[model samples]
Target: MNLEARKIEFVQEFLKLQNEEAVSRLEKILRKEKNASNERIFEPMTQEELNKRIDKSESDFRNNRFKSSSELLAKYE
Candidate 1:
């Protein structure tokens, strides 16, 4: 009924698929889930975006930006 249960059911159904076409479909479904999970775990962060963000933060610190490290830590945490 829930997400985890659905995932397990998907795997069970995938494993049970006997026909070549059915197995291919199941493989596609599994691949899609795998890609989605991987994307969520390791999101694309371009070098430029990372560099700009770091530069902005370093400048912010030099300029004595708001409050404290706790604020920054909250963003990263």
Candidate 2:
């Protein structure tokens, strides 16, 4: 079956579940899978990349090219 269909089927089965332990296991599995997926997406930057970012930040500060935290917060509010 396709992914969407499979997800619907899974949800239907999950909704009928009567066991707390089974639901807890599913929640733990989902959290673990999500964390692993995030780790893969956000791999640590290299030393060279870190240095480049630091230099850019320093330049922006000297040039007054950045905004304050209050200014940023005000923008969304």
Candidate 3:
């Protein structure tokens, strides 16, 4: 009923699990869900913040201080 009780129940049931494939699938699903939840922890930027970032980026471009996409990708490849 409570969170701890539910976790205990889940652990008990998980301990009884016998299927390797099912456990692997469950592990992948849990990991993917955890990653997705973590990615939502950041709040979206406000309009003013967005505009400031855009202006800074334009300034950097005008100053020739930024890398091109092809140049960036070349390093990884």
User: Across residues 1-77, which tens digit of lDDT does each residue of candidate 1 receive?
Assistant: 99999989977877887799988876798899999998889877899999999999999989988568898899898
lDDT tens digits, residue span 17-76, model 3? 999998998899899999999998979999999999999999999999999999999999
lDDT of each: 0.87, 0.98, 0.95
Q: Model 2, range 1-77, lDDT digits (tens) per residue?
A: 99999999999999999999999999999999999999889778899999999999999999999999999999999
Query: Backbone clashes per model, in order?
Result: 0, 0, 0
Name the 10 consecutive residues with the lowest summed lDDT in model 2.
Answer: 36-45
Clashing pairs in 3: none
Our model 2 lands, by Cα RMSD against the true structure, at 7.0
For model 3, the stretches where C-alpha displacement exceeds 4 angstroms are 2-4
Clashing pairs in 2: none
RMSD of each: 12.0, 7.0, 2.3
Candidate 1 has a TM-score of 0.39
